[model samples]
Target chain A: MEKPKHKLLSFAYFLESSKVYNKIKKFVYDLIENDEYKYKRYFDIFMIFVILSSVTLLVMDVKRHIPHWLDDFDLYFVTTIFVVEYLLRMWVYSDIHKIIIDEYEESSYFDKEVSYYSLFTNIAKNKWAYMVSFSAIIDLIAILPSYRGLRVLRVFVLFRAFKMLRYTKSLTGFLYVLKNKKFELMTLLTLSTFFIFIAGIMLYVFEGDNENPNIHNLFDAFYWALITISTVGYGDIAPVTPEGRIVTMLIIFTGIGLISFVTSIIVSSFNERLSVLREDRVVQEVGKKKKLTVVCGYGLLGRLVVKGLQKEGVEFVIIDRSEEMAAVAYNDGYHAICADATKGTIFEKLGIDDRISHVLCLTSDDIQNAFISVNVKSLNSEVYVTARCSDQEIATKMEYAHVDQVIMPEEVAGMMGAVYAGEPVAFEVLLSIIEEKEKTHINEIAIAEGSFLDNKMIGEVDFERLRLILLGVFKRSEESKLGEFIFNPSDEFVLNAGDNLVCIGYSTAVANLKRKM
Target chain B: MQIQKDILLFGYGTFGRQLYKNLRSRGHKVKVVVGLDDYVEVESDSGVDITRINIKRNDDILALNVNAAESIFYCAMNKTANNLFLVLTLKSLYPQANVIANSNSNETTRKLKYAGATSVIDLYEATSRRIVNVLTKPAVSMALDEIVYKQNDLQMLEIELKENTFLEGKYVSEIKFRQMGIILIAIIDKELGYELVFTDHRINHKLDAGDILVIVAKKENISKFQEMLKKG
Candidate 1:
């Protein structure tokens, strides 16, 4: 954001500040690289078709006289695509305009001339970094098959197959598993190298002269040793002397031990990463949805809230700190993750975007719930958050954090106990309705504009006919612009558009009433 | 003459103190009893009688006039064992006393129900469920809060129908409770296996004797409705 010296001539800074350029760059980046992009699947599928046909055509070009048109197609049409794709990848690799502007600004601050040479070198350095990256190198080689002089490099056209690594996820997942087991794999590599060298030297010394035709030179002996250690048992090269056979036997046992060690390491690492992969898939799935409810705990209250949400048929994702509880929720057939809710980037990882409508923080710890609510409101102020607190002081803190609702379980329990003590049957009557234990739920039906219920008198809607008990109506007041609850509204209460009618009834009955509206 | 102390609270604890205050604020004549020596000494108020006794024993329970009291609340806070024993002893002795117990968990609620408690409040489940209700059904919860949980004249009163009542032989569709300006939420009848039959049930149930009507209304309206039921 630092202003360049004399903005007009500072073309780099001017380009850097252009919003359209940045947007286009981001669009192309998402199109090619962002896995969570909605349209990337179709893009990848198209590229897979292109890659298969290109490789198949190249393979057949050696013997069968492919039509000249197909050869020209591979040479011109395919190479142009490879070159353009490589360029686009390089362009989105990093912001070269920013690099040049930063270098220019630093040089000006030092009271020196803006050396165009330094800026050029800086831009080149960044481009080189991306060009040497693993995927970029594969991309560069994929274009080499078009050159006639580099016929040896033509064989490297098969390196085009490695370019498929960019499109396929399983290949990258395997690489990630191997990368996580690098330390154990390195140890195994060292142990195998040591044995291969020792066995190669002994084999040449014992069988090089006459006992074995396969062991003429040190290179041949080393190749035999490697094949034996790999447990391939090609048997093309066999040891004849007693000493060589003894070394072969020991190396074979070592080979088995080393192979098993490598397998277990990779398998365990994959097991550890499977949960991560599954969560990533869940996040991707959530990205495609809107108006998702994010439940931030998997405790008793969280379970109850999730159940209510399920009954309401709302889409929701859950996050909890305890792996066991999260696993319990996941096993209960809910999409849940063991993750810290207060982490700044967690919202993005959950793929909530701006579409998260509500967040329910029901963790046992009051401080954690408070922070979770605060974090959610910070990310999206429009999201309604309900947080649980154990005491009044923390409840006030939750309010300051702009939480929509603060639930104090102990205080609510105390009030409930009192209510039960004074009017036992009344408490049961209300609680049965509230808890839905009686198979009846309290629902709010909003009167849509121009609907049958709109602009009608309350008396016109027959309560006995609908078979739904009307509790009250929450009318949106014009002056205050807030919904006010009118308890036990009388028959004179005129039904207006935007009025929310609260009622108690069986779920099916409520749905029936809703259909009428 | 001494005012009738109609309510007895046993095993005073955190929830016990709150319940006592709530009952007192609602104009109920209530007394507290605790077996823990320290709780009795510390929480005992001068004006309110705080009796210290072994509530687990039947003799001590009877000594407190457990059966004579209209309602007995066993609020042992976290001690489920004492609550179970107290409920069992009082039920065994009185055989008809209304015993209400507060349990810390659903498991304890089941045990208390089995031990002959007339009503068992699962504090944990209630707290969690209230939070859930507030979260999932904001508008409905706020409406319920105004009339039910919050302090107001509006009350939920259960009126049982006796024989020869005007509404006894009428079908549910024929009777109009809403004409009295009270919402009849549900009907609990003994012959219906004690399950709450919501007012919105598809079947047009016939109103019979011994059926209790759960109605929500203002205090004066409730009294008016009771008088109308009695006269008609």
Candidate 2:
């Protein structure tokens, strides 16, 4: 009785300490860091919106007199939420450190176990680091009391608007672009600075002690130069003499050119960075999917395949050799890689062999198609390969290379033409099947083991009752013969365990049949 | 047979524009169908006034006499569903007209085919094939250069040896390919696969009756080689 009681006590303790600890850790971590978590995303978005609104309100309050009660309510509400967020972030600060340490500890240098005291010390150290971070400082400023008497205290409220940049992906992307183009931007900055300084000095020298009331001192001339060069000419400090006016005109033209140049640079950088971000997003999306098709080539056939896959709501990535084709694919809103598909490293980089279900080598060249087929097969022998061949010779070669399906476009075209000529109605039916014109469509449904329809005679089961038309049955077996398609099978045919029913009907009816089976 | 080849292009995107350019360059009369949202009167680079019809309304589709056009190209934007719907509508209106469509995938190729497209060009496959060919087959590129740029009469021919061919009993080294000014690239044997005969080891081997010699030579020399390989 004492043993059982002790065991129960220990179990309860374990439940209270370890389980609850983990639960709290996960909750806090999700709230603070995990953007992908649904609740966390919503919470973050709500906080961002709140920050934006409060910042806007504060800005307006400074411009004009807002009601006292409204101001107090907004301040208290925003501060309370921010205070709670800050505390939660602080609580999860140790977890973030642990995650970082765990991630890096795989390296030989970091393999030592962090003691409880060291962990506590480390958390404190990280907390200090976090407090000093740009976002953290902004958050603190947003929550801190703004002394009503002090005008400088009101300026801290504007930092809350900068907090929105942390939440918005595009703004972060813009910042990333700025970081990447820092060299060019720095050059532009230094040139503009030099021009402004020279123009200011020239104006100061030309207009000092002049009759013009506005250009009284070097400070005023410097101010005028800035205003004119930025193309924000307020006409406050006009140049009195022709020499001053000509210098001003020259400064204005340089400013216009500089502004345009900077604008163009920023726009181009934004585009480049955005494309990279989009590619990363595509990779992430593909990673989340269980099995995706990797299409090597974004040429005519590859483009068509991507469209078809997209229409069917299938996830796929396109690999193309040409930069132009890859760019086209990317613009078409498909994840694309502009690299040689023949390289085994490309497949490895894409994690194609691990997660890819199918690989379609739709390149027109027979040799390349064969190479891709062989390479993919070597990577993942289980991955289904479908290759397009120009002729029968290439088709034979592809078959010899172990490509599952070798499609000949000319042959298909010829067959399609023959079908069109010989049997128009059949062709129409085929078209209807392919296009899935209406509610009525063809689908392949497998009969699982122990299903009511499994091992039952076709005559015993009434497909008509379910509003399903059985077109054919495919019996898959390991012995004697491989899978055989029994087209328009008689009602007397017995359903096998591994038989697949190829039926035509409304989607609902097919689903109903599947459910019953 | 002399009927005017009036080409109708659906969707004025990249593929459609490319098709229009190719057709216009060949001096074919062509009209483009663009969505009402994107429709704008524009001139081709070659100074051909691009006739763009708005395809937003059913009336717009009806206004364009699709049946009168000799060929219709469905080289629309990347929207396969929209393209499929357009193909279906076009097929329903003019079943006899030769309709060509571009598909992005194999599944869409089937759908386009069944939708009554005379030919469905898989853009990805075609482009990939072209790129691969250009990269791997330098001889093909050279041949293309000769034909397209140089306008030379060079030809690459695959000559199959008959049972009693004049060259059947002789070794590859004794063929006097240098005298013929022809390059024997490889031999495709039925029993054995493609055997590239660059070095003396394979060249010294006796030629078989069923062997196919892949030879690259001038047009005149190809005929001469073919004649020499024929039975007496």
Candidate 3:
């Protein structure tokens, strides 16, 4: 019993080192970001405490009912968590080698590039780590004792918490738009500056140097100009003279123009970013899956392919240069890149060299599709490329390029239109057949030692129990090296430990058999 | 007492350097050409006009402190991103400068506007408009746009060399627009890299494709120039 207990402890340690543990850690990290559980509850409680502490501070300041213990308790609770979080983050950063390899390391290839360097420093320097992280920054600012002794920072902290709203899909979509249209927004800000600058100068000249000593110089004038242009006119600074009033009027007019410009930029940027978010979500389901078909075009025909692929969870990348058409794929969370896929440069830029098992060139242009088919072959001969051709003559060209399939969208549309118009039930039956076929498909299973089918003859294995049919036994002779295998062995052949069995069955049946002895 | 406005030209490109000399000679209010990158940084021996920004990011436009000036002429032919980026950033950061800029295209003009450009002018468009004016009303337009005085009977014409025009082979005076009541002011022929004009030195220069000819003429004789241009 002691030996078994010790073995269990060591086995647990072994499990920790495996990819499964890494995957679990990643999922947990994602969960924390989502803030759906433990962190969200903790945050809500902390927020309540902050609010209560602020109320208490206000009451005490006014010489009202004051509880010293409440103040101490709030301070201690906030400080303790802040310290703990800081320490934990530091510890994690110190053990970063165990969690994630450095980017310079070859093994770090799969890891995402961390966008914020400040976050890394907090993890590196254990002191006040949580206080510096984006959310924590807000918290620290909110609790600072400078004005109202740091309670002023709470408003900022609330704003930071509002950013956490990005975790919600809808809010995240909005934020994504904001980030994507950064340049456009920047442009609007730039344009507004000109008006502000001119207005500032006019105010300074007209208002006089003696009255507003702050506006004696251009920088002061500029500061006033920005505030005035932005319409955030703090009454601390005001123009006194009649000339200053005229300048103020000019500044106000310019402010209107600047506001309109900024609004337009944000609106355009929002739409652009939203479209991109929708595209990315489309292909999120097929991550790391194999034997997926990548269809590059998104047209009336492309929709059919997407519907079929989505039903089967088949991995794919959709390449459509048109932003409007690609918006559909984006909404679905599919891997979509906006570029002229017909260009060879796009392939090089996208790094789509040979990783793809299959390619579907379904662009409307027959010549372009044929060109891409040939290009795909040149890039990777083994990739099973299919193309859509408008003309039947292009079929010969597609064949010359060694395309696995040539689908004519017009022909298919005509057939579908006729069938759907004449017999709705027949169309439904066809759809049902496709759905059934996708749900159950042939997959190869590798034989392992001590497995039930390891030494059994093909006929001896109980296929009836599995609700599966033995498609073929792929066997490699002992004399032949790796990568050399014979397909569809005879029924008399005994299944060896190393042999791969190609079986056709429902997914559930295949999964059960794979798990069973 | 006449108070002089001290103007600073930051870039020393064709427009920057030209505006500097042009404004200076006239004596209205012109100072010096300040060159920071490769060009000389002009500052009075006693006075160094400087403005500081307490921000982490370095902006091109704000650094120039153009808003502090009565007028700033920036014709730095630097990277569009570097130039407009700095300009627009400065406009946002400091909104006190009257910035008159030179842009390359319509797209950039739009960008310049958004970046807080007070006034944006395209070099190509300005040159094109000058050419169109000269060709249409050589006498009146040239005196006003180019020569700036009625006494200096100078006019500018930007002509696109036709595929089979006789003047393609001949030099400026040899092909002679004077025969059509036009005086050639300047020939902007890229074949030679620099714009050749009817100056005292380079009067008999050659013409080529994409050459813009700036001509000068009297107000009454400019109509004859149109007839000559239409004939061949």
Where model 1 places Cα greater than 4 Å from the true spot, the runs are A1-10, A17-20, A58-65, A148-152, A351-353, A378-380, A420-424, A478-482, B1-21, B29-65, B68-70, B73-117, B124-136, B159-181, B187-213, B219-232
lDDT of 2 by residue, A325-443 (tens): 88899889888877688888767766765788788887767789889999999888888788877656778988887887676554443233223322233334434433454455556
Candidate achieving the largest TM-score? 1
Is 1 or 3 the stronger prediction by TM-score?
A: 1
Predicted structure with the largest DockQ when compared to the true one? 1
Worst 10 residues of 3 chain A by lDDT: A414-423
Tens-digit lDDT string for candidate 1 (B117-199): 88776655655555556655667777877876778877776777877778877877777667777888878766776666777
Taken in order, the candidates have interface RMSDs of: 3.6, 21.2, 38.5
lDDT of each: 0.78, 0.66, 0.53
Best model number under lDDT: 1
- Listed per model, the TM-scores of chain A against the true chain A are 0.91, 0.68, 0.49
The CAPRI-style docking tier of model 2 reads incorrect
TM-score of each: 0.87, 0.53, 0.37
**Alpha-carbon lDDT of model 3:** 0.53
lDDT of 3 by residue, A9-78 (tens): 4554565577876675555454344343446445545545555555455456556645777556545665
* RMSD (CA, Å), each prediction: 4.4, 21.7, 34.0
- Which candidate, 2 or 3, has the higher DockQ? 2
> What's the C-alpha lDDT at position A504 in model 2?
57
Question: Taking the tens digit of each residue's C-alpha lDDT, what string does model 3 give over B95-183?
Answer: 87655555655677788888887655443332322222222223222223223222243322234454444566677546634345453
lDDT of 3 at B228: 46
